[model samples]
Target: MTEPVDEGLVIYWRPLCGFCQRLLEALEVAGIQATLRNIWDDPEAATFVRSVNDGAETVPTVVVDGIVYTNPPPDQLVIHLQQA
Candidate 1:
């Protein structure tokens, strides 16, 4: 995972999650670097995810340019990352 960048790409996820794994893999394949935050390990990240997802600790909660995108499609996320 890449280091966190100011107002850049950030993904809040967790282990044993198929959606998270697939999304991360797709981003890597698409050459889109991002900061990964594991909700299990980071309390603040977990809270943030819950806040965005209506109290669910949803994996693959992505943040780009300060805008939250919950469970975004892989291809769309890649395009958004490239554009940002």
Candidate 2:
């Protein structure tokens, strides 16, 4: 898959992460468009997540307009989406 573009939300996640699922569902419910990148499936994505997460692979890492947020609450994400 291609690297995420700079214009929209990009979520770095992993399988079996409840938080990731929750965030995805919330985004859908809120009618927000975001690109979902599974860390397990993309080595570059995993590395990016690690770079911001103290060298650990953390799920629900979100990038929006070049800003990074780790495990943000759904409401917080919605606010950011609206701002964008």
TM-score, model 2 to reference: 0.89
Model 1, total clashes: 0
* Cα error of candidate 2 at position 48, Å: 0.6
Predicted candidate 1 versus true structure: per-residue lDDT over 19-74, tens digit per residue = 99989999999888888889999988888888778899888999888778889898
TM-score per candidate, chains pooled:
0.87, 0.89
Least lDDT summed over 10 consecutive residues: which range in candidate 1? 1-10
Model 2 per-residue lDDT tens digits across residues 1-84: 234447578999999999999999989998998888899998889888888889988889998988889999988889778876
For every model shown, the clashing-pair count is 0, 0
